[model samples]
Target: MSAPIPVKVHYHKQARELELIYENGERHRLSVEYLRVFSPSAEVRGHGPDSATLQVGKKHVGLANITPAGRYALKLHFDDGHDSGLYSWDYLWWLIEHREANWADYLDRLEAAGASREPLGIEIKQL
Candidate 1:
């Protein structure tokens, strides 16, 4: 089975989400923080599962840029200075398929580590 191809990709800065429209007429939206924490980059994934780093205080992280990495992957640049992940088409499909479970597991891990998704210091809000 091959990965589903995305016909369109849009970044909604206000919403902080990446929207993907697939050839099969399916659409999915993923948050920037979610993508960051689940990045395929070695910095996030590490050498293996046991070495994987937990990305904390990323609730307010934003997507700085998105560039195509050849024809099969995307290079996502985060505002927090992370730009090493290469999100392949196959991997992206898997992420969309397992988003809920993965997010839940991440939250559990954060709780266990006594960490938080909230950024440190005052997060000023605009009215």
Candidate 2:
């Protein structure tokens, strides 16, 4: 069997969801937070195996832009200044298929590390 190909892609800012329509007539919706935390960039996934960097404090991150990458993948630009991840079609499908398990793992890791999805507020002190 051949891999599934996307027929259309839509990003809803208010809902913070990415809707993907596949050629096989399957549709999938993925949240912005999930995509951001699981970005396929080296900055997040690292250069070698087992080097994924845990992305925290991105529960409200928004998609700034989505640019096509040579008809094989997409370059997602995030509102938090992240624009390196190239999400391929296969990767997107994998994310959709494993959304539940992946999210559970992320939550477990966050709890174990005492990390939070809420952004940290920085206070500036005036001298």
Candidate 1 local lDDT, residue 41: 93
Best by the lDDT measure: 1
Question: What lDDT score belongs to each candidate, Candidate 1 first?
Answer: 0.93, 0.88
| Alpha-carbon RMSD to native, per candidate | 2.4, 4.2
Cα deviation of 73, candidate 2, in Å: 0.5
Estimate the TM-score of every prediction: 0.94, 0.90
Sliding window of 10 residues with minimal summed lDDT for model 1: 118-127
Report the alpha-carbon TM-score of model 2 versus the true structure. 0.90
| Model 2 spans with C-alpha error above 4 angstroms | 122-127
Expressed as tens digits, the lDDT of each residue in 1-127 for candidate 2 is: 5358798999998999999998778889999999999999999999886888989988888888899999889999888889997998889989998999999999998999899988889633222
Best candidate, TM-score? 1
